[model samples]
Structures are given as C-alpha cells and as structure tokens.
Target: MSNKSSLNLEAINDFIVNWLKSYAENAKVKGFVVGISGGIDSALTSTLCAQTGFPTLCVEMPIHQAESHVNRANEHIDQLKARFSNVFNERVDLTPVFEMFKNQVSTSDNEAVLNLTLANTRARLRMTTLYYLGGLHGFLVVGTGNKIEDFGVGFYTKYGDGGVDISPIADLMKSEVRQLAAYLQVPDSILKAKPTDGLFGDDRSDEDQLGASYDELEWAMLEVEKGKKPEDFEGRKAEVLKIYKRLNSSNQHKMQAIPVCLLPDKLKLL
Candidate 1:
C-alpha cells in the first residue's frame, strides 16, 4: 500500500535483521518458533527469520481429517527443513483436539458463529503447537500474518492467529508479501499461490473469504492512506467503506500494545 513502486527489499531485510537482533537480545529470547503452513505467508516469514540468523523452529500443524491439504502444506515445510540449521519440523495432527473441542462445545443458533468457532479452534490449535515449541526452547513465536489478510479484512481469529510475541511482517500487504517472497527467492509454487487459512474447505481462499482480491484491498488501503473515503472513488464507495470498517475496526487491538499505566516513578530519570 506504500506506493506501487518496488521496494528495496535489501533495506527491508536489513531493518528486520537489526530489529530481530535487538528484540532477541532485549527480550532474552532463545530463538524463534515459526508455524510453516506451506503457504506463501509462512514460507516468506520463515525465510526472513532464518536468513536473518534466528534459529527458527518451523512446525507443520494440520488436522488429520484434512489430510490432503496437510500434505500440500508439508511441501512448503520440506523446502525449509533443508535450509535452516536449527529448524524443528514436525507434523502434529490436530484432529483429536478439534474433535474434543467440537463435541464438548454446544453451538448457539447462529451458523456464522458456528463456522467462526471452528475456524478459531483450528487457529488456536496451531498456536498451541507454536507456543509449546516456544516454551521448550524459550523461543518467541514469529507471526506469519500480513496486512491484507488479517489487517485489511479482519480475517484472523482473535487470540488465535492473533497470539504472537512479535510479527516480522504484519505491516506488509498481501502483494508486498509476494514481493518479499520473490526477494527471498522462495519457490514459485508458493510465490504465485492463493492464500488460505486451511481451516475451511480446501477450495476456500483468502480472496473468497474476504469477498475481494488483494488488488481491491490494496486499492482501498491506498485510498485510506491518502485520507480519502470510498465515496471519493465513485461507484466503489459502498464496497470500499465496508472493507474500510473491516480493515480499521477489526484490527484495532492488534495494532496496539496492551495498556500498562505508567507508575509515578517510571519517568523519574528518563
């Protein structure tokens, strides 16, 4: 969304390298625990963390019921398994977890809530695995989310995909994610692929879930960046604001740090 001109990804990578170094040193974190879903987002994120010298632990979490997509997801993991030095690649089948939570929980009359609940379950399950790894090695979880998918459409599950110690690429739009993927020389299979949560039907993708493509989301975000509303664009006004609220409202908490009231002595000697 920060203009269509290509970015100097070397500078981007350099900035992240310093950020990662400072973050780990200050936080005293052992390393990074990354969830690699064989998707472009995860692949690009993992590659960035690894290239920047973090000992990234990449996990492939999938529900056994969705075995086919799981297999497809592993291909992305396999590529990284061959690259990172201290990578931990494991496939934890989440079928039992999903089944247990699904059976014990009673749904309300709302179908939308039901679907969202299931998706959140999948997301939380993945986060559980990531956190487990983080606990084992004192690593911090690295988020794979990008601006367009989670930030633009409010598509991620709160407290689910929202759980992370740090996000290396949360500021990036979906198109910019692909651009970084290209910069990292990520495989073409992932570079040009559709983005999906792998929580719903195998056919469902991010664009379909959001009712708009990355191109549309990018246009809308750019318009917002220029302090213009959807009405300024003529026919797309309604659609633009609809997404504007989604992008703006849904990501409110994600864009901020939790409130920690300053103590009286906190500013004593700054």
Candidate 2:
C-alpha cells in the first residue's frame, strides 16, 4: 500500500525501465515477448518494455475472446506501435487449438471441471505461443500480472499466466497499477475497464470471480500483513476475512515454487 505522498510515477518508471534493460542484458535476450489482453496491466508492462528501446512483441492470442476485448487490445497495441519504434503487434486465434485440446481430455459428467480446465488451458496455450515466439526471437516473456494477482491472492494459473521470464508489475497492487497506467497515459477506456483474465468465453470479470473488488481484497491483505485479525474489522469482520482467507489458502500454491523431495545423509545411515 504505497501512500500517494510517497508514490513517484516518474521514478518508478525510470527504475522499471532500467531493470528491464539490465535483465535483458544479463539474460542476453533480444527483446520482450508479451501477451496483450487489453488489460491495463499488460498495457503498462508492454509500454515500459517498449520504453527500454528494445523490441516488445505484443501478441493478441484470442481464443473465443469477446469483440470488445479484442478491440481494446488492438487499440492499445496501435497506441504502443505509434509511440514506440520497438513495438510489434500480432494476432493468433487459438480457437481450434483449444477445441482440439478440450476434446482430448474431457470426460462425461464433469462439465464444471471441464469448463475450468478449458479456461486454464487457454492460458497455457497462450503461454506456449508466447514462449514459442520468445524462443524464435530470443526474447523473454514479459508477464502482465500485478501484485494482487501474482502474490496477494495468487489469481494466476500456474505455468499458465504465472509462467514468465520476468514480472515487472508483480509488486504493484491493482489500485497502484491503475495509478501507474493513468500516468503512462494508457487509454481512458482501458484504464476504466473492469479487470478480467479474458479466459472465459462469457468474459466474467476478475472481481465477479473473486467475490470482492480488488480494493477490498487489497485492503484486507494489507491488514493481514500488518498483523491485524479479522476481528479488527468489527462490522465486516466475517465477510472480509472469509474472502481473504479463502483466496490466500486456495491460491497459495500458485505463489510458491514447485516442491521437491530431498534425501539426507542421515536417512542413509538410518
């Protein structure tokens, strides 16, 4: 929770730009590969990548994407391309790929699980495509996740949206991301648009799925970080704490590295 008085947009931008430059130099990658879903997070990230004077490949991989979502993504990419010489935009429709995948693993009498599986598959497919492009051109995949999604509640799918070589905005909360987006002159329509993962065909918003707005979730997470209990909320204690706990517990795995088993010399002695 960065205070307004302490938040310096220019400094943040400068730092991220330098970070990207240094990271690419160290990795020996040519540029950044990003999946642009028209969300402000992607918009801000790609914009920052472009500012590094390195190629920023913005791929719009629409698998049953809503028309509005596609339009917004194109609009943002157009803005980026117009402003930056290093910006590149491409569209790859993955509908057939998804349908083929859905047909392969789907079983009868589990429509709900199958539906969720399909959504996650969409994310992984996009990830695969981004990595393919990244490998082809020696670019690192630049993730579009923010603090609340990547760390707070872990809203991203593991090895799906969670798979990336670098995460520039993963520490900025959703509200702070909106502030940065506004400062970066992101289009007003995208800045005000409801946040969605754009994975579902019906286009459910992130808040609709999370059971609470990002502002509420961010505040609750901060309170929990400050050693405040649910009882501190008084009126909304039960409601707020429930959402916070459910999200953190369920999505914890996404935030953690993969677990590995280890054997010790003491075990050999035994």
Candidate 3:
C-alpha cells in the first residue's frame, strides 16, 4: 500500500485545483460552494476550491454545533478569506430550523432510531441550504467527503453530504487528506482536532462511531480488495475487519448507484 509519505502533495494539489477550475468553466457555472465542518476534509476541499481562482463560498450551517467545531470552522474560513482573494463565507444557524422540523415530525419510541433520524435530518437540512445558496448564486455545491467516508464505509448521509456537484478529494485516503491539508496550510487547530460529522450536536469523534480508525479501515479496505476474508485475520485485526465489512455491506446502497425501476418494452408499449 502507498503511504502518505510517498504522495506527491504539490502535484496532487495542482491537479485537483485545475480539475475544479476546468469543471466549473465547462459547466458554465459561476463558482463553487462548500459546507465548512471544521474538519480536515472540508478544510482541504474549500482550500482546493479557493485555489481554483473561482469564487469559492464557504458556508457554516451549524445546528446545535459544538463550540470547538464552530471555532475551528470560523478559524479556517477566516484564514482562507485572508489568504485568497476569491474566498467568501456565510454563517447560517440551523438550530431553530432543526427544532421546528422535529416538532413537525412524530416522535419515535426507539431512542437509537430517533437519534439517527434526527442526525440524518441535520445533514439533509444543510444540503438543502447549500443547494438554495448555490441556485441563487449559480455556484456548484462542492462536497466535502473523503475516499474512506464516501466509498469505504459510507459514513455520510444518503442525499445529504452525498449530494454534491463535484468531489475534488474523493480519490484521496484519509491519511492522504491530512497530508494535503497540511501542504495547503490548513489550520493547525483543525489538523489536530478529532474528525466528526457534527450531526448529533455533540463532540463524538468519527472513530467513536466507526469502531475503527481510518488507518485500520484503510488497511481492511485494501485487504478486502485483495480478496481477503475475515477468517484470514485474528485478534484486533479480525475485529476491525468485521467492523469494516459490516459498514461496507450496510452502506452499499449509499455507495452504489440509485435503483431505477425500468418497465419492460411490452409494458411500456401497452
């Protein structure tokens, strides 16, 4: 497996920036909009978008977001705006909107299901806000998902964070993301902070929810690609493999293309 030390950070950065610029120009859009989550992924994404020289709008949609998250997000946005002439930012507090949505929906007796549903709701609401802003400004909604979250474990909401016009860093692993982030001068605060989706209004790290670190998950993903099975491993390795497999299986719907019910030719003719 290729390690982060072997990555050509400068070349990778140039390629992604050029790609973002070319896609936006070909699509005939004004610029790009990204939801800044104060995490490494979003920081790197917004930075790449800004480097494209297009108008990159970094939006903070906080719905009961933790103070650390808000601070890091603001810090990163501020740094980006100061560094790049094309960078812009917006703060849209969605706490009240989320509360109103909860009131409109029926309550669930299952605590786990209810919490999960609300977390997804937060993601969807942020997605809606991003699209609304994008539509108004002719900006493409840029996604902040990394390779592991988007493909390996499907750690993102279906249409929420998954809904994006373009993904610049989806091809890079989590370790590679941190490498590029440091190369691009992302804030030290975010670099050191724990990764979180920030949907549950708490400080629970992504590792806490995934049951394995990105390093473990990446190893398991690579092993699976090499046709390895759970029985081939033992101890902590086996546990991590099972965790990776469980998430990969359950989240295939998110990773794969949406299903379309196609009618037969005869039925269509009839």
Name the best candidate (by TM-score): 3
**lDDT by candidate, in order shown:** 0.76, 0.88, 0.93
List clash counts for every candidate, in order: 0, 0, 0
**Candidate numbers sorted by TM-score from highest down:** 3, 2, 1
Provide the clash count, candidate 1.
Answer: 0
* lDDT digits (tens) for residues 247-269 of candidate 1: 66766775567879787886686
The predictions' CA RMSDs to the true structure, in order, are 4.4, 1.9, 1.2
* Model 3 spans > 4 angstroms off: 1-5
Give per-model TM-scores. 0.86, 0.95, 0.98
Task: Estimate, for each residue in 113-206, the C-alpha lDDT of model 2 and write its tens digit.
Answer: 8778778989999999999999999999999899888888889888998999999998898888888889999998799899998887886999
Superposing every Cα of model 2 onto the true structure, what RMSD results?
Answer: 1.9
lDDT of 3 by residue, 1-270 (tens): 333458888999999999999999999999999999999999999999999999999999999999999999999999999999999999999999999999988998999999999999999999999999999999999998888889999999999999998999999989999999999999999999988898888778899999999988998898899999889988988898899999999999999898999988999884
Angstrom error at residue 145, model 2: 0.9
Show model 1 residue runs off by greater than 4 Å. 1-3, 64-68, 250-270
Strongest candidate by lDDT: 3
